[model samples]
Target chain A: MEGLQTVGSALLTLGLVAVAVVLSLYERLDLEREIGVAVVRSFVQLAAIGYVINFIFGLENLGAVALLLGGMVLFAAWTSARRAGDVPRAFAVAAVAVGVAAVATLGLLLALRVVPATARYLIPLGGMVIGNSMNAASLTLTRIRDDLAEQRPKVEAALALGATSRQAVAPILRVSLQSALIPLIDATKTTGIIFLPGAMVGMIIAGADPLEAVRLQIVVLYMLLGSVSIAAILVGTLSYRSFFTPRHQLRKGVSG
Target chain B: MASLKIEVRGLGYGVCGTEILNGVDARVPDGEITAVVGPSGAGKSTLLRAINRLIEPSSGEVYLEGVPTGSLDPLELRRRVGMVFQIPALFGTSVEEAVLYGARLSGGDADPGRLLEVVGLDPSLAGRDPQTLSVGQQQRVSIARALALEPEALLLDEPTSALDEAARRKIEELVRDLNDRLGLTMVFVSHDLSQVERVADRLVLLADGKSVGEWERGDFFSEAGERARRFIAGRL
Candidate 1:
């Protein structure tokens, strides 16, 4: 295939975005402005990331890679925290969840020798893991908060019966974590059957060996499951504490 | 006379700079049903919750059988002083499971059938889902669940407020039976003065977040203050 120039590539993507904008406008969806903003923001953000990744990938030091990865997790946490709404210190919870999940998953992979501990291997993989984990944290926290609020009487009844906060919120936590994992589980179950995943397809388009791409994609999928589950669990456990007082009283008005 | 089962001294709860309960003091004697009654927003429920530390008092303390509520582990305190809400909120999938929930959490044993029977429920209802039961039946299941904890006291928050006349009578009879037979210390929040008249041995009158007066049933009906009289007259 002939290589397209940067301007040509940009215009091609812009053309696709224009199609979406036109459809939204014709449908009176009121999403045309949001689509335009998202397109612009994504373009700028991806361009900045491209430059940053280029700089980091050139460096051999682990410290630079860690710093960049930490920044990504922090940014992802802040975004997720917005969805967390009324939970006190929601941003801290998100940050801790994302940080813990990413570190634990990456550490396991390194210990298993599934992936080498190098910036080349760590940055992209860590970014994907952290991004999904952030989503899992936010979804679990928000859902748990909503569930707790909705089931306040049930929880209070449990607490009144001598159940601890953990005991009282167990059902709510279970449902929240399961819900948070559904998207990732669905994607994993359907991978390569309904649609080719982006990572594998990207590798294939870039001329990598198809078998190697599939193997890498499998590893990525498994890693995502682990990271998301851990993130959900941590977020659910920590965020629930904020919903009740030390005296086991359910604090009202915690809903977003 | 019964000893003081729970003491609330200067008990106050403030939320968002507004006081819900302020410096309210009262005594709930053992082996009797004491009803906290007043006009709406009188903090009757708040007082009940504070007894078990479910709503931590902003100032002052609750003494449950001599131990300050603040000094006890909340779970332990709650186990010792269980509560039943106006609307029964049962946990677990089935009535049996709901009854067992407290026992399981507390690492104790309770026979669901026996507990249900004690609360005037059919043992056959044990396997049924609590949601499938009538509101009154569910309330009985709620009482059975609390009883499984073997609490020294049971706080009832408008326990019969949602029931029909028949169910209300059933609950009132049950409360009286439990108090008379088991010598249970019961503190209930009630808006229905007639229901209060039927069951309460002593009454605590609250208005504007303070304890306006405390009286025995006969005294309250015949010798109440102007504020208390207005409450009784449904004018407050």
Candidate 2:
């Protein structure tokens, strides 16, 4: 009963504070509609997620867990592809690739008992890694596509001058991959000094020791760096080929 | 003996089963500039691209220097035959890097100073970002980059259509200079008849994806085909 009351009180306080922050930001930054939509969607989505997670946790079946994870991946992929307007199919492939690679690598760490495979630990950690990788892949794919479109004439000129499609598109590929990796590098550089990331703070709030929380955060950070790096590289390389035909000419339909 | 540099026979392309270039047949000569002039949507660009296999021909073959383009590795073929575009398409942040892109692709070293000089650009402009340069400067950089491969043939698609008058003159002058000095075999597509007259050694007039007539530079303006006359009169 007390636990329910505490959760209810905390929820109300959080809701009020969130509303205040959104209102203030909207007023100051002129992002009113965006803030409104984001807040409303976040509230509804979080509520729905809370119920679904409660149901999943109650079941505690490994198959159910796997199914939920798959659904999460698909959802992440779909969202990323939609956000990346042109090359939706390629973006979808990139998202799936990143999600699978990141989740599998992180899952192995947990499966190998490198990290405990508790639902509380695994689900959120996997979600964070997948989410970050999805963002990186989306950015990388979009940037590469845009770069290719913008520099198409130059690419053609290169092809005319004996450069393969890979050689022709190399400049854009290198730039996009580097740009996609920037956030991961920045976060890694600034970790613990500039910010205490959510996972570590959340763990501490959940009654974990500070030292343990920090240690787990470090693992999460490293996992994210690895996953995103792999995602960016794979997405950039594969997407370069996606824009070209088998004959190594830029495909017309692939244009943005 | 005059030898053909590029031969396109019965080339066609389409999307979702609609033909874009239909039965395009033409031969680009080894040491001359051939201007493909047509109204918009007449497959002028497609025809130029077809030579380098930039656009896959749905039902035809392109022979580059007596070797079928289809049989030859596209990378090797493209390396020997370079293309320029309507817009200045520089990829890198700086002008020098954009010029170096082709050289890098071909695994050749770029002499930036010489390339800039050939294109009539100031050497100081190399360090500036390509986006900061005028359209004319960017186009010149693109030309220089294409030349870096020391290609036997050069394909251009409406290369001067995007520039202002001064920029257009610069490109026209550069095209003439390159042709005369380097003996670069050039194939350029354009809708502007005057520009074609100024740059082309020969003109291949296309209408509705078919070649309607061919004329040498001296006789192109006096050609008698109705479509050619209409094109010259800007009735196209």
Candidate 3:
């Protein structure tokens, strides 16, 4: 009955969508259809997930919760792997990176009782951690792969000088990691002053206390930072090996 | 007359079925400069890399000092057989750092000052930034870097193609001088027949990824070497 009332109230927010559509119509911004589609898709997706999450919260079994979270991590890994072009075995790299980061961060949160051991808290928070880690994993993989190609002469120069593949790429790994982490770093830096995060705002909209919302949002930010760092480091460490042979020679066709 | 310092035996390297070095063979005599000369796309550079195992050969083995290089640890092999590429690809920003890079990799040290002198650069240049120097000086720094490994043999892949003619002559002199003074086995690659004649004790003429003819410098320039004549005539 409460969920039904919330959905009824949310339907009144169509006027908010119409405001953007009206601006697009007047200025011919070419975004009216995209806005409409995004709103519809997000509404449908969130509404479906809401009912599913409601049902999971009722059952409250640990195994079932773990299975759902594992599915999210797998999809995140697969999506990130595809985003990284031309890297061989990137799927396994992404899976290990994103999966480990999520497990470590979420496991710690649950173990510390900072968040309750329930599907309601776990599913939404897991989405935030997995989604951010996935972005970091893909960004690091793609940047490292491309940077290796761009820095081929430097890398090959190091290799020819008898430096191991690890030593040769260690410099590049630093730069790629910085590239992956910069976005999360900036968002964390400006979180409260610039804008309230979506999770915090959602909590407030659901009638939770603002201070309580801030507490969860801070945890979300720190979790993101830690997970993104782990994912970036792991993806970089794993992907650089693909560029070299076991003899430490830069493999052919890796540049492309 | 000296024992062969490096022997490349029927080496073949291909990429995606396009053969880059096909059954190439060359013998680099000890303490002498052997120039691999070829036209563009002749796999001269590829042949040089095959010796260092920078580009692993598909069908053959390279022997260093009578030992099959494949049987040795590759990092140790590379340290002993250093290579200098065409672009003077210096790694670190500081000249001293670049010169000492190989040394550091082997957990050893070489005097960057002495190395700079060996490659015809002032020791003071070591303190300067390599990127700020002229291309010739930078190439010399790269050569110094290779020498810092204390390699038994040095492979130079067109070490002066990116330099002007004067710089090229200076590098040629430095290479010849290194051979004379250090007794380091020197194998250099170039398409310029004139450079090869000026620098090499012996020559390997490559065409279409194969060693078509190998000759002492005396025979290569003389009239009796008919295959050399054909290559010079662009008839091969």
Q: Can you give the lDDT of residue B166 in candidate 3?
A: 94
Score candidate 3 by DockQ: 0.76
**Candidate 1, residues B28-143: lDDT per residue as tens digits?**
99888898988889888888888888777889999987778898998898889989998898876899998888889878889999999999998999889889999999999999
Model 1 chain B poorest 10 in a row by lDDT: B223-232
Candidate 1: tens digits of C-alpha lDDT, residues A103-150 = 999999999999998887899899899999998998898888888878
Positional deviation of B79 in candidate 3, in angstroms? 0.5
Q: Which regions of candidate 1 are displaced past 4 Å?
A: A252-256, B223-227
Model 1 scores a TM of: 0.95
Q: Of the candidates numbered 1 and 2, which has the greater TM-score value?
A: 1
- For model 2, residues B88-155, the per-residue Cα lDDT tens digits are 76777888898888778656887887899998999888899999998888889989888887889999
TM-score of each: 0.95, 0.81, 0.93
Which residue ranges in model 3 land beyond 4 Å of their true spot? Answer: A1-44, B230-236
- lDDT of each residue in A37-95, candidate 3, tens digit only: 99999999888877878888888887877888898889998999899867888889999
Model 3, position B210, has a per-residue lDDT of 87
- Candidate 2 lDDT over A1-256, as tens digits, reads 2233454665665666567668778678666666668767887888887787788788877677667777777777777777777773665676657776666777778777878765666677778877888888889888988888887766776676666778778878989989988988998899889999999988787778999998988888888888888888888777778788878888887553
Q: For candidate 3, lDDT tens digit of each residue in B1-236?
A: 79999998989999989999989989998998999888889998888888888878899889998899888888999999999988877767789998999899879999999888888888988778789999999999989999898899999988998999899899999999999899989888887777888999998888888888888999988877766767655832
Over the full model, what C-alpha lDDT does candidate 2 score relative to the true structure? 0.80
**Share of native interface contacts recovered by each model:** 0.88, 0.88, 0.80
